[model samples]
Target: MRILYVITPSRLSGAERMLLRMARVQQRHGDSVRVLSKPLDAFERAAADDGIEMVTGAIGGKLNLRACPTIVEHIQRFAPDVVLTMHSTGTLWGVRAARKAGVPCVALMQAANTRWPYTTAPAAVGCAEFVRQHLIAGGMSPDRVYAIPNGIEPEPYLDDEDRDRARSDLGLTPSDLAVGTLAHFTPRKAHSDLLDAAAIVTRSVPELVLLWAGEGPLETKLRQQAARLGLADRVRFLGYRTDAPRLHRAFDIFALPSLLEGLPLAVLEAMASARPCVVTAVSGNPELVDDGVTGYLVPRRNPQVMAQALIRLATNDEARRTMGLAGRKRIMEMFTLDGLMQRLREVLEREIRRQRGPGG
Candidate 1:
């Protein structure tokens, strides 16, 4: 199968990484895959490193309707079996391009950051079931939306030695509690709330160390919050990291206090690495975390509740181990990277056939 992915990404983050994984899997399966992206130095470099073919384009937000012709031209040139759009802007033009080029188009909704994409695409794949419902509630047909959760490769994280090395680098001792968060330091991701919870959690557990890995516009603000809360020494911002699975192995607990999410890849990677998560009970987070079984789910923006949950896991070694093991088991059983690709493959093939019609 030939799949053409379109996106207008400005950062090399979770969504971009997941798209790269999808392209890699297709290439490995003797399938042809090409990407159309707005030129981002970091994201372009990452795609190149993966040996994924990418063509830079001017495709972007609502105002960039001029990109539709270029996208259509590319579609004509590549002549893919299907065009899979990534998120909003990608969907906006991709769906239009596919329609013009007379091919099937499926948009992957990372989040309901933009609702217009749902109305435009013939079929949409949501990163989480929550996202599917969100689109359906906005009046998209039920049959046209699919809930395909993000997944990860568990083998790479199993028994990783990077854990000890990371601990050592952070000046952490065996007795210390290392809390890790891998997310873009953005407002919606609520890194500010995490800092507040960290301050509260630290009052009881002073041995707590935080490893925040990711850089964004909000990084400086989050750093200020950490210092303001007297957590300057405790929090270590690792900056943007591409080696996510390895970094996930370095933490005892993985926490993300996002205001909303569409099955965050960080949480999936953390679970695959056998780390208990303390994430905000928003969007698809509740679906992944079994609340005391796999991990604890705290209310959005509630630093007090988040801190309480973190304190519970930090104080009990057995609880942490049990939850971590359960999380990993959940990932292995339902969220393997192979499982995601298979599901996506089904969607892509089905969409292509649908576009071709019964006798084509």
Candidate 2:
């Protein structure tokens, strides 16, 4: 199968990473995969590093009528079996171009509560069930939307020596309890709530440090909040780490207090690294966390509740280890990279067959 993926991405976020993963898995499975996006950035560089062929085009603005011809030209040149689009802008233009070129198109919804730009595509994939319902509620047909959660390769995250080295490099002692998160420091991610909870957690566990990895628009503001709450010494901002998978080993508990999510890849990475999570109870979070079984789920913006949950995991080492094990078990059973690729392969093949007819 020949697959073409179109995306309009500015940074290396979860969705962009998923796109690369999809291309890699497809290529490994004997499928010809290619990616088309704007001028090279981290996404293109990473894809290139993986030996995937990437094509750059000007996919500007919301509708980008000018880009439609370019997209159609690429579709003609590559002659892919199916085109998969990620993000709103890419979906809008890719769907239009696919229709113009007479090729099958599929859109993957990466966030919750999104307004899908095109309704004519044969099918749309949501990263989680909540995301699918959100698309359906927003006027897309339920039959056209399917939920396919993100998955990860557990081998890279299974290194104990790398974990210990990361802990030592971060000045985190074996006796110290560390709560960590790897998310862009944006408002919707609720880094402020985590800072508030960090202050509260430090009042009880003085050795409790908040290790944050990632940079965004809200980095300076969050740093100020940490300072204002007298957590300047307790909160360590790692800032846009490339080695985040290894850094997961330094954390005693992984937490994400986002206002919303569509099956965050970071949480899954943490679970794959055998760490218990304390994430906000919104969107696809509940689906991943079993609330006291795999991890704790706290309400959004509730720092008090989040802090209490963090303290529970911090104080009891046995319970933390147990939950971490359960979380890894869940990922192995349901969310492995092989499972996600197989499902996506089936979806793309079915769509292509439907578009080409039985004998074509």
Q: TM-scores, in order shown?
A: 0.97, 0.97
List model 1 lDDT by residue over 52-162, tens digit each.
999998887778868899999899999898999886777888999899898898999887666786677889999889989999988899988899998887787777666
lDDT of 2 by residue, 1-360 (tens): 889888888788999888888888889889998898977578777888888889899985685678889899999999988999988888889999998898888998888756758455668888889888888888888877788888998887776677677898999887788899999988899999988898888888988989999999999998888889998888898988878677888998999999989899999989988899999999988888889998999999999999999999989999999999999999999888899888988887777787768786
Q: What do the candidate models score in CA lDDT, each in turn?
A: 0.87, 0.87
Pairs that collide, model 1: none
Count clashing pairs, candidate 2: 0
Tell me the spans in candidate 1 whose CA falls farther than 4 Å from its real position. none
Q: Residue 29, candidate 2: how far off, in angstroms? A: 1.0
lDDT of candidate 2 at residue 173, scale 0 to 100? 86
Model 2 spans with C-alpha error above 4 angstroms:
118-120, 357-360
